[model samples]
Target: MIRKINRIFQDYMREKRLKIGKNIWDRKNKEKIIEDNNFIEDNNIKSILFLRYDGKIGDMVINTIMFREIKKSYPEIKIGVVTRGGAKDIISNNKNVDKIYEYNKKTSEVKKLAREIALEKYDLLIDFSEMLRVNQMMFINMCKAKINIGINKKDWNLFEVSLKSIDYHYHISNLYLEILKFLGIKNIVRKYDLFPTNYMIEKLNLKNKKYVVFNPYAASKHRSFNLENMIKISEIILEKNFDKLILIGTKNHLSELERIKKRFGDKIIIPETENILEVVELISKANLVVTPDTSIVHIAATFERKMLCIYRREIGKEDKNSILWGPNYDQARVIYVDEKVKNGEEIDINKIKIEKLKEKIDEI
Candidate 1:
């Protein structure tokens, strides 16, 4: 198809640009930053730059906790975040981030942006993604920071310092926090904070209510519940005596949501905006939240709210099964369908029974 050909052409161009950009930078080995008693003390680290350019909303949301922990570890240290414009909200309001440089993807002038960030002369730069793609490593070299750090990998060879996880059995957030712990950040707290503006609070208007939230979308079709199954789950949850139940997702689901609203009465509400903060605000006020494996589940944990989570079987080693992302909090419960599947077989959301979901909801 023309669309697939166009996609391949675009990818080729991006790779070409990345290769050109890598050559433009001074790609040579430098001194590696290691964990020492006087690592921070000797280097006189005053400010740090964290590079994570993944535009996915969920990745951005989870990194907020990492940013907060870095600030808490050193009250006086300044923090800088470099991310895409689409993902800026995750770190925009955090008091810990003294500077945030967002990449405008429509007109990407990364070299120009790098020149400006380099002028800041950050004491340390860390790329958390550890991805070796052209865009991932290009800016780290261009920044001209004193000590560059990233996760250790064969292709992540540009940074002066690289940190890797000693233990692989931890959630993504904890895996990221290990970078700080290696740098000797003492008493790091694993907490997430998003200070909502007064307008945001008044917008959703679920303030101090005994309502619950239902998010039926995930990153992929296989991960999210289908409309028919979602409706069934809603019917089961409605059997409970909760105050109000809100149904929300990205604008892609608007048509389906309208159908659900028509099928069910006014009890199921829809959000006016697609901005993720509204979801967080709703989650913050809700007595309980139910969602498939997505950013909503992570946000629920960030707020320490009671939640029931559902996830599909991760087909391969890197698919991130429930054991990896399952909530560590006592208030959280997860149902992993087809937990024992070994090969990369995609499981349908409809395979989960209504009675099974109701049993989980009844416990809540």
Candidate 2:
């Protein structure tokens, strides 16, 4: 498809430009990132800009804890976020964020955005992404801010305060907490908040009902459980007298879930598509959630809903992605299986037996 071709071209161009920027163009400035790694305090800071390139739901949701803690510590300071275009939904109607800047992921527009953000004169700048994309790094350096903070585990650094020297050994949420501590904000947010307005509450009729929610898809195939297996699990739960199985997903997943509905009949409540708030609204009403290693898991955790997370060990090691991103609160269980297929690994998820899934389901 044309979309796939464009993504390939974008990645190629970004890699090419990063090579050029690293070896030749911005070599001196990159060196300067290492020379100044000490902490810099800004007592009169009033405005802050946050840079996050990966705008996936899970990425944004995890960072919501960071956003909340920052605003809680400094109620008067204005916060601006620069994220990939479609990801504005994560913080779209959020009251804590003052501005949302959209970057279309083209290397061509880096400088233009840099000039625009520089004029705002942010007192603090933070890069929350794990991999420092070169064009984004270049933009981070160009943006004028008093105290610049970037996180990386190694020699790569493009900000005045680099955490590369310190090995981060906590969960993703805790990692950000440590960064906030370094910035002189010691009070960390212990809770995650995703507010749903009355409009969102009235959007769905499933409120105050007993339903089991199923998130059968993920951003990548390896991270999702097999749909066939998902159906089997749904059958098991329905037999236990749960009200109904609700399947929530984005537009790309509509047809596949439609097929599931065709086979399962009215016992399944398959919504064609649900936006982030709608998903949150539905999950907040569900009795329990069965999902893959996706944002739904994290969001369910925020509500403290019981979660049965199914994931592939190959996608991440036990410590890195499994334990780190597993349910932050209580009442959650996880099952991992070795993957067999690289793309859309329906068989990989089959490695988890039906009885094992039922046991976890029954526990909830």
Candidate 1 structure lDDT: 0.73
- Top candidate on TM-score is 1
lDDT tens per residue, model 2, 1-364: 8988998999899888777765542322322222223232334668888887677767677777767877887788889998874356757888888998887667668788888988998877887756656676678767867667666624544455667433334456677667767766765766666765445434445556578888877766655656777678778888876767888777777787788888878878875444577677677767889888888887888888888888766643334566667677787788776554555334356577789888888887
True lDDT of residue 225, candidate 1:
85
In terms of lDDT, the best-performing candidate is 1
**TM-scores of the models, in the order given:** 0.86, 0.83
lDDT of 2: 0.71
**What TM-score, to 2 decimals, does candidate 1 have?**
0.86
